[model samples]
Target: MTANWTTYRELLLPGLTGRRAVESELRRAVRDGRLRPGTRLPSSRDLADQLGVARGTVTSAYTQLIGEGYLVAKRGSGTTVTAACSWPDTFERAPDPAQRWRFDLRPGLPALNAFPRDEWLQAQKVALLALSTDELGYPDPAGFPLLRAELADYLGRVRAVATRPSEVVVVNGAAEGISLMGRVLKAAGHTSVAVEEPSHFGAADMLTSHGLEVRPIPVDDKGIKVDVLSTTDCRAVLVTAAHQFPLGVVLHPERRHALLDWARAHDGVVIEDDYDAEHRYDRPAMGAMQALDPSRVIYQGSASKVLAPALRLGWLVLPPDLRDTIVERKRLDDLGTGTLHQAAFAQLLKTGGYDRHLRRTRQLYRARRDALLDELSRVLPDWTPIGVAAGLHVVVRLPAGVDDLAVQERLARRGVNAPALANYCRLPTFPGLVLGYAALTPDRLRHAVHELLEAL
Candidate 1:
């Protein structure tokens, strides 16, 4: 079957077109079923050579087809036909046929390649050298005293959260924070939690897994609607106030006030997930919502976005009353986050190394994001990349009736790793793909954009 491509091409030569010839050939291939859905196309160099055309011409042809939803590309894999239109509906079902893509653009991740391995190792070595014998024994259930103090100071300065050593509970990461909070909140007689529509599905799912009724609150360009929130009888609302996941809209000052007011009036608590607030590329960064009303907001921040997710380091600033309950839950759960890593992180913070690392990565990510936007502009004229101000991803909204999920499945079959935005939403809405750019190089980005357009 693979050899048939060249064997058939010899009998039917494909003419080269400096302009519209490529587009015409693409249309012909799709019509004739020569390039069926989920069919992996050859690389630009290979295709260009096979068709006896320049590589730029191949790129142009693929770009045109991608816009029209004919092909797709993924990281580490070349192009392929969109499986939705060409194969069975289950074509390109996610988390399957692993290694199908050549490029991955899914959101909510930092570039693991850029982790500060040397600096972290140095900090760990220093901490270990200075450690007392007693430090290695059974750790404090709350957290390492040094890490808690460091987080207390750091959150105070950057996030303006009313954090203190005693009130800060360290978990393995934000996931644990959610679980701990859910456990405590459930124990306190809260059975329902209101979440943002199109919110972090992972978080919302976690809430549901804990047997709490999950209600969806609508989100506008500003942030989650505060008026609709008052209608619900929920005991808590989980919010990504600083940089809302997927959408990347910062909760405005007025909305923040509204949220705080709602929390105070309803005797409700706000679980703030400050997920990627540190990697701001737009205006000056905003502080945590807990700053406005500490008692009503349980502030959660993690090193996942800035450093890496594998660190499993996160802190929760709890109200004075719920502090003991959350800590006890943490103790019963994972015992506690490791002492040495906490100590090393503390040293990284105090010595100014972590801040410097963040500054460097922020600059690199900003450059990569610019490259992705620029490529989108050049390759995709009609399509606009939304939510470009901050975060690792940009949303490309296709015109109405585009079926972004279908287009995404098609792209995946073609070897591109872009996921549809519809996957995140619990309710039906617009069709778009979330394109993450932090981990890709400029050359890789250009190739991905070209392949994406071809797959579409």
Candidate 2:
């Protein structure tokens, strides 16, 4: 007779075998709450058959578990999890409720669904095959040599970032890179750092958390107000120069020179967060501010937007004087990022695969951005879309007296997740929503925009 059995395929490990493994699996399941109290376990014979083990092994495991108070067995009844046992906390954090949305328009997220998996896998294989025992040992705190070299070349060619391989330090991501820079700046006795007014909220938080005083510098259609920044005594400033966040304005040519001049005159530093500079649609390419003065600027870039955030791979092109300290800081933080992944990324870059992937994805994103704008024009004609020329998201400015947070909450109830502009600002100034388009298809983008309009 066919017996009813719940699948326990995930519990099986290749190295483990026999009754001991079975007992361990059962114990873990009960302790972890995967098998709740009074939950019925499959019969020993059925479990044994499914696991390709002897029924005696399953029976022995069940007997041991029952004796240990994890399970109970009775005549004419099956083995079941016990109710009285307690387990130590594993300390796993709960998942974010915001991630449960059916349609998410949160800004700064790329098209994760379109990641080049097969190409990455092949590159990984090639990297692994080429690695020696020495290469697999402790990694360089700066980064993989090959990746640094390739990145130096690529950055120079693509973004006009002036740097050598030795100046590049591989970081976990832009977030970590910023934190490290903050710490280094604090250690150097810098007390205050100026940040753009409506900049990335996370960037401000990271700076604050690192014990630096955050000074907000207002941004306009021309980007960060350098004239106002010159008036402040902040020793350092963080900026998104290529494509300003939320407002989507490129740093004006005069402002770029003025920022560098301000840094040079005050001996201050510019932490250029080169976020989403690659996804430009309407504008000609802009060279990095670091290229103008590498000594006074810390240029940060990440694979998150172009490739995938899950990779957590980023790079910082530091000035020569700051390189040693930052490398030391990286050594203390996780002893450098994963070696294998770095090697694979280097291989991807070396093979020109990275460039090819970017070309394809950029075209797709441009199309998606166009669809989002077209739909917005039709459905929400009154809402002005800002920063639409580049990046994965656009900022939609609302009419006067419209509460963006209220609209966000209302959209959340309908399974659409969009962030309010006020959340990114220190003071309430702009009333809008930051809507991402790259993650969703054109059809879905149109439908989501329609739904948003209807909800409004």
Model 2: lDDT to the true structure: 0.83
Off by over 4 Å in 2: 1-89, 92-99
lDDT per residue as tens, model 2, 1-456: 123463555454433355567878777888888777887778766777777776555665765566456776543455677666565657423324343456778788888878889989999999999999999998999999989999999999999999999999999999999999989999999988999989886787788888989999999989999999989889899999998887788889999999999999999999999988888777667999999999999999999999999899999999999999999999988888888999999999999899898888888989998998898898889989876478888999999899776566556546567777866777668689889889999999999998788668
The worst-scoring run of ten residues by lDDT in candidate 2 lies at 91-100
lDDT of 1 at 207: 76
Q: Candidate 1: which stretches are off by over 4 Å?
A: 1-100
lDDT of 1 by residue, 187-302 (tens): 88999998887776778767777888899888778999999998889869998888777777788899999998888888889999888877888677888888888888899888
Model 1 worst lDDT window (10 residues): 89-98
Clashing pairs in 2: none
Q: How much is 34 displaced in model 1, in angstroms?
A: 31
